[model samples]
Structure formats: C-alpha cells, structure tokens
Target: MFTGIIQAVGRVAAIERRGGDARLHIAGLPLADGKLGESIAVSGVCLTAVAFTPDGFVADVSAETLACTTLGDWTVGQAVNLERALAVGDRLGGHIVSGHVDGAGEVLSRRPDGRSERFTLRAPPALARYIAAKGSITVDGVSLTVNTVSGAEFGVNIVPHTLAHTSLDGLRAGGRVNLEVDLLARYLERLLLRADGGGVNLDLLAENGFLKQ
Candidate 1:
C-alpha cells in the first residue's frame, strides 16, 4: 500500500513494447534502498521493479494497465509521480492509497484559487457513485480531498506545494488522469451488496446519516 504522498517526480526514460505489453525504465527516482521485485507506485499504478540501477529502475506494464491508465500514452521524458510502498512505522501522511487505478478521469477545467488552484474532473460513470464530497480521491496518484461533487464531476484544490512536487503541474483541460477512489468507499459498496437481501439496508445507513434522501 501507499500513502499517496509523492516522494519524487521521475521521468520515463524509455519504453520498450513487447507485443501487447511494455517495459518501462524510469529515471530521476531517488530510490537508494530500492531492490528488485519491490513494489512502487508509478503514477498511482502499483508496478514492481524488475531491474534496478543507481539512477533508475525498470518495471513491466501489462496490456490491461495500458488500457486502463495513462501509462500507455507515456513517452520519453514524461514526468510521473513516484512513491515507494509504505513501510512499517512510517507516518501516514496522506490517506491510504492502494495504487490500483479504479478508472481514468478527464480534466474538465482548472482555475486559480488564491495560492492554490481548483481543478474539476469528470469521473467515469461507473466510478462516479464511489466519489463523495469531502471524501479522499487519488488523481494522477496525488491524494486530494473533494471539495464538491456534481453528478459525475468533482472539484479539488491543489496547493502550490502539491503542484510543484508532482506531475499534476502539467494538467490541463481535456487531459486524462488515473483515479483511485477511497478504499473505504469501495468496500462499503461490497458490504451493502447481497443476493439474499440479508445485508445492511439503506434505512439503517440513513438512520446514521450515511445516505441522503
């Protein structure tokens, strides 16, 4: 698991296609203690390091990952948010991020908000139900709080620090981003699902204010 805090902004050094899959070599990651077979969050998608060098490492991306994320569109020198897996006793700086992209979203718009910037993004129809106002969501591997929700869209404020530290600085309208909704929300939906109608009901959730209307 990852904490969704970006440790470094690495660049795609090379991409070698192998049939439907591809191998990626990333540079600029400060992974001094990194080892082969270690999991790393590469722009919100957990990828394993198959080879390692002082300045970089290599990982394989499957065809499914390519179809689900922006990794397929990556090119040499493309900046990517990088984070090592959370270690024992490490501080949970941000919300728990599984580094599993649930779906991809499109940047709807971006505008200034004081020293920060407010970005609105449109989530996939299937993933929209998992997003909530004030809930945590990972966008392009950066964990952010949703300030507002409107149907399939939500807005988040990106502080200057986050903008400078990650690749989100390059975000623009019409751009696509990898999104991972809160893990709790995903599990909650599963808990409510039932084939025998024996699971928790909306009335119970509504009594606790979990559901509106």
Candidate 2:
C-alpha cells in the first residue's frame, strides 16, 4: 500500500522485453533501504523490486499491467513517479493508494489556475461512477481531489510544489495517465450492492444517516 505521495522522480534506465512480460531497470532513486522483493509504487502500479541496482532497482512488469497502464508506453529516459511502500508508523500524507491502476485516463485540458494548473481528465467509462466531487483520485501515483465531475470527466488542481516534485509537470492535453479511484468509493459501492439488489439510492442514504431524515 502507498499514500500517493511521490518520493522521487525516477527515469527508465532500460527495458528488457522477455516474451509477453518486461523487466524494467529504473534509475535515480535511492534503493539502499529497500530489499529484494520489496513493493514499490511505480507511477501508480505496485511493482516488486526483484533486484537492486547501483542507483535504483529492477522490477518485472507483467503483461496484464502493461495492457492496463501507461507503463507499456514508457520509453527509455521517460520520467516516472516513485514511492516506497508505506511503513507501519508513517503518516498518511495522502489518501490510501493500492498502487493498482483501475484504468487509464486522458488529459482533456490543462489551464493555468493562478500559480497552480487545473487539469481536466476523462476516465474510463466504467470507472467514472466511482469518482465524485471532493473525492480523492490518484493520477500517475499522485493523490489529488476531484474539483469537479462531469460524466466520465473530472478536474484537479496541481499546485506548484506538486509540479516541481512529480512527473506530472510534463502533462499535456492528450497525455495519458494511470488512474485509481478512491478506495472507500469502491467498497461503498459493493456494500450498497449487497444491501439491495439495486445500487445506491436516496432510501439507502437515509437509512444509513448519510442524508437528513
């Protein structure tokens, strides 16, 4: 598990394709404290550190992960967001992130919002229902709040500190990103489904005291 707080911006040192899977050698992140088989969040994907390198680590990307995320599109020298797995006592600076990309999204627009940048992205249709205004969403491993939601599209504001520390600074209108919806939203949907054959409704919210009586 992770907190979606990026620790470092690493680069794809090399990629070795073997059959349907690929092994990635990532550089520029300190791996001294990490050991072999440790879990690391590589741009919203939980990848195992199978081996350690002088400056970074190596991880194997499965075919399924490639097909589901932007990792498959990564080229040599591409910048990637990196975060070590959360320790037991670490502060939860960001919302809970499973490092499992739910689906990919495309940036529809990026406009300046004062010193910050406002990004509008379109999530996969199936994943859109889990997103909500003021809810947390992980984009390329960075946790952000949904400022607005319109159908499958949502908006987020990236502050200057976030831009300077993460790989999202290079984002453009057509760029694709890995997206993970809020974890609570997923479980809440399941609970609602189990409570009734139908999904969330006004009656359910009222019964649960989520709405005024």
Candidate 3:
C-alpha cells in the first residue's frame, strides 16, 4: 500500500532482461531505511526490491506488469516517480494507493494554468467508468484529483511544487502514463453490482461473516 505522495525522483540506471521478465536498477531514490524484498511503487506499479545498489535499488518487473503499464517503454536514464510503501504510523498525505496499475493512459494535452499545469489525459475505455469529477486518481504514482470528466478523458492540475518534486514534469502530449483508480471506487462498484441482483448480495456477505446477519 502507498499514499501516492512521491518521496523521491529516480532514474532507470540499467535494465536487464530475464526471459519474459526484466530487472531494473534505479538510481537517486532514497532507500537508506528500506530492506530487501520491500514493496516500492515505481510509477504506479508495485515492484519488489530484489537487491540494493550503491546508488539506488533493483526490482524485477513481471510480464503482466509490463503489459499493463508504461514501464516496458522505460530506458536507461528515464526519470521515474518513486514512493516507498506506507508505514503503519505514517501520515496519509494522499489517498490510498495500491500501486496496482489498472491500465495505461495517454496524455492528450497540456496547458499552462497560472502557476500550475493543466493536463488532460485519456483513460482506457474499460477503466473510464471508475473515474469521476473531483475523485482521486493516481497517475504515474502521483495522486491527483480529477477536475472534470468527458467520457474517457479527464483533466487534472499539477501544481508547481508537484512538478518540481516528481517526474510528471517530464510528461508531454502523447506520452503514456500508468494509472490506478481509487481503491474505494473499486469496492463501491462491486457493492453496487451485488445490489443490482448480481447474486453476491448481503445474504452472501452475512454468510461469510462480512456483515451482521
């Protein structure tokens, strides 16, 4: 789990392919307190730290993750957003982010809005239904609120501070990004489906001790 608050900006120092999977060595991300096998959110995808390097860390990217996110397009020296896993007592600065990329999205446009940058992105059609106006969405591991929605297209404003602290500043029109919808939104959709006679109703929930009978 993560809060979607980027802790550091890193770069893909090296990439090594192993069959269908790939191993990435990241540089410039602070990991003095991280341990081996720890979970880290690398551009909205959860990757396990397999080794520690003098500069950064190494993580293995599975084939499924590559198919679902923009990580496969990464190359050496590519800037990336990095966020450590949320600790038990840490403050939830951003919304709950599972680092599970539902699908990839494309940057449609970018325009200056005062000190901020307004970006419009098009989400995957299958995941568009989960996006809502004012709802939180994680883009490339950075949590942002949807300003408006039109079908699969949504707009978000990135403040100057965010741009300076994360890798979002490098994005341009036509760029692809990893996207994760809000966690609660996923559960709400499931409950609504069950309510609409999906057969997984409250009776089943009670039977499984998920709710009081």
Write down the TM-score for model 3: 0.91
State the RMSD for candidate 2: 2.4
lDDT of 1 at 132: 96
The residue pairs in collision within model 1 are none
Candidate 1 structure quality by residue, lDDT tens digits, 47-69: 99999867889999999999999
Candidate 1's TM-score reads 0.93
User: Can you tell me which runs of candidate 2 are displaced by over 4 Å?
Assistant: 199-213
lDDT of 2 at 122: 100
Measured on C-alpha atoms, candidate 1 has an lDDT of 0.93
Over 50-146, each residue of candidate 2 has an lDDT whose tens digit, in order, gives 9998899999999999999999999999999999999999999999999989999999999999999999999999999999999999999999989
TM-score of each: 0.93, 0.93, 0.91
In model 3, where is the ten-residue run with the lowest total lDDT?
A: 191-200
lDDT of 3 by residue, 1-213 (tens): 999999899899999999998999998875777799999998888999999887789999999988889998999999988988999999999999999999999999999999999999999999999999999999999999999999999999999999999999999999999999999999887765655576666777887899975
Please tell me which predicted candidate would have the highest lDDT against the true structure. 2
Candidate 2, clashing residue pairs? none
